[model samples]
Target chain A: MTDLLPRSGGPDPASAPGPVRRPFRDLSAEGRGRAGGRWRRGRVPGSLLSRVERRERRWSAGPAPAAPASRSLLAALLLAAATVTTLDLSTDHGPVEAARGVVADVVGPLESGTAALVRPFTAIGDFFTSRSALRAQVAELQAENDALTDQLATADVDTRRLATYDALAAEADDLDRAVVAARVVGWGAAQTFTDTVTIDAGTEDGVSADDTVIAGDGLVGRVLTADSSTSTVVLITDADSTVGARVGSSGTLGFLTGRGEVSDGATLDLELVDSTEVPDRGETVLTWGSQDGAPYLSGIRIGRVTKVYSSLRDSSVRVEVEPSVDMTSLDVVGVIVPKGTDSARGLITGSSGSSDTSGSDG
Target chain B: MSPVRTLVTGAVVLAALLLQVVVAPHVAWHGVVPDLVLLVVVAVALARGPQPAMVLGFCAGLLVDLAPPAEHVAGRWAFALVVVGYLAGRLRPDVAPTALSTVATVAGCSFVGASLVALSGLLLGDPAGVGTGELMLAVLASVVWDVALTPLVLPPLLALLRRLEPGPA
Candidate 1:
């Protein structure tokens, strides 16, 4: 009663408390006996409780623990991964590169064998598909031939002059360097996230990185990476691929970048040097080449200007150019091996669908 | 992991990598192909635990990085797949998901994986010029392909994994 009364401003309960609030273990024997055990006395079923307990146990089982050795091994592997990535990205050749070379050596034969096995089936399919395509092509060529026949009669004298220039160009191109013929073994998959192709020709056959690769139509791309018996070519339509280009009759200087894919209906982006000078549509584009014509020759046909637009970043004008070569159906191609190689002086040919490298230059 | 199980896993991974390199190109549309290697990692992680899944992921990634036609920085795929393997391993408690749910998981994980790959490439300042828009498109297409192919790939992979290590469950 006295504790319940206010002291100064409030009552002091602790002073007048009859039972102290102590822990269960600290409670006096009489207090412990008097405390209610409601949970034990509850009417909950033993079976239900057991079930719940079992479920809790099952659910509470944490993930499996890895052995210490494995953990250490994993840590070591991760560290090795970091080191390998750094070495691989920073330089060309390393232990990782040696491993890659080994993989290429081992897997290259398997890939080639698989390709050989699959070619027949694909060829059959292509044969069926090309039959209809050939009919349409024949009709188209027939109409073009008739048009050319009339034009040829009228321009016989001019044709001879153009033929002479064409011959001179081809001779000069061949005289400058020899082109190696190689077969397209495989195309880059979506998993690779690159627009590239693998060819059977490699360093053993004089194919090296940064060499110019082309098809019968025009400029295909350049060699990206090469193994002893295999080489990877980054197509001109690859998003990362860039080539110095000359646009139209005036040969306006610009550079071409790939749009990542050809089947997706993407076009090459051509950024010209002078934004003020916009090239007309239908103008031919050619490779301006580097200083020594190593990767790209001075007069390789690239594409043609289709549309023109203003540059977003600078005063230079940007235009959309359509690649002249049909990138999707590259079966056979040529690798322009520069002069001064240990291989044959003329050309080092590899697995080829046909020998189309002799005459075709730009 | 038993030696046989490890060997079988290795063989499966090598087969998937081979398919990715050889057969995937034939079916690829618009520069997007299903990530068969990632699918293997996810399936194995779901069956097995994180430790093995992550190690396998690292090895698979390294192979992809070192493989020919890979122009980007090495170990990029390894890093991305490791994250995916970890995420997939987090679902170990719910080991046996429904078929539809499994499809969803693959698609969802593929999106995360692709985005992670793109982000890593961006962080590394990819010299290959993988643009954001193009990468996004590739990711979307990849998710579609992964979802479509999950039914075919996941079940067989899960069965083989189960057969290899029956004691885990």
Candidate 2:
């Protein structure tokens, strides 16, 4: 029974003292036997075999090791699959929408409270900011006010004549394009692209998609999202925003794109057709519209081109037009509610700007 | 603390997340914002060991991921939070108490977490630095807020976690 068992598998001291079943079992297993250790007489001894194996391993390996292609390809494929999976899993509005609703419910009041709390801080900030520039602004305003007052005092018409003129003017029906009023409700809160704002008026409120939303002297944005109590008005100066605006006293038609409103140095891009011609600083830009044609909210004042970029090499004007909206200064402002426009719009989820998919100007 | 304390710490993390979603956007500093979730994460990591910190991070990150306008990755935050928690947990307990260290931990967690999120954006082929500056501003403000507020929050939370522990004190 003991002889029937292999020597390595069982205690078999009796069987032929068993060649120990020790080292270098096969020709394949014993490659370069003398390669690992110091050999006496050019032959490897069993005593030095393990050390020889160690040296053999060290000798075989070189530096520029190549990873297995199958594994690498599999890893790359897996990575690609994971990336796509993550994308599919990551980009969704459901959680966000629910969270928004819950957050709005919980945070709305808190925000209102915070807004209230920040009032004191705001006052302090205003004090500091106004202190530095207040003197200059006051002097400028006082000079303008004095000049205007003098002009008013010198050019007083008779009350009867003025009344007659008012009656005729009132009956004539002002033919110039006018903007309707809307209210701001929400901000886009987007990280990269911020060419949108939410206004509290929609098609039901005589507001429609594509109807321009203006704050005061310039365009705030176009109506992208129009709901009953809200409409996301993409601002004109958003990085993704663009408009066809007329510049200067010459009414030069040019494309006004947003050139990242950085710090107090907010600038609008005014790309003009004629490279030779450049808009002057403070040249007002208005939405190119009809003067007497059907009341299609046109010729609406957009902004004043502040800094014209004419490097003599760059074709585009890259004019920095300061918007009339005074983006940061606005607490509440007028949103143009163009007349005859329907406010009743079906809720379109995720589709932006109704007619124009890409909401920016060409 | 005990294992029970650890679980309670997780609940506290959830509570903190809810508070963040409900309140952080409103706490404006010069119209910039703070990240409340990051604040609580650092706080917990400071109080607990790495395992518990990782758990707190995961739950908090998931909650933030579940928050609005942020719906894409439920697990990415888990991955990020674990990393933050692991790293922060390794800090000396004494360092956790200091205002500077507290703010540093919060800022670090927020930076790491937000950077991880940007990785997702990069995968989608969006431009690099998308929302990063805003995220940084938000983290910076939150760190300031954490320094301002964590001292107020940490002791009470630690007491609460200790009390929640099932075993003897």
Specify the highest-DockQ model's number.
1
What's the TM-score of chain A alone for every prediction? 0.64, 0.49
Query: Candidate 2: where is the Cα deviation over 4 Å?
Result: A1-134, A140-212, A222-233, A259-262, A273-276, A288-297, A314-316, A338-362, B1-32, B44-101, B117-169
Candidate 1 local lDDT, B1-169, one digit each (tens): 7899889988888778777766666667775677888999888777666677888888888877766666667787887777677767665434324564567678777888788777766777654666777778878888888888887888777767755654323
DockQ of 2: 0.04
lDDT of each residue in A81-160, candidate 1, tens digit only = 67767887788677777787777776665666666777777677678867997898899789969977896788545565
- TM, every model: 0.74, 0.54
User: Over the true interface residues, superposed, what is the Cα RMSD of model 1?
Assistant: 8.4
Give me the runs in candidate 1 sitting further than 4 Å from their true place. Answer: A1-83, A92-96, A124-176, A190-193, A274-277, A310-316, A338-362, B127-130, B166-169
CA error at residue A65 for candidate 1, angstroms: 11
Docking quality level of the chain pair in candidate 2: incorrect
Which candidate leads in lDDT? 1
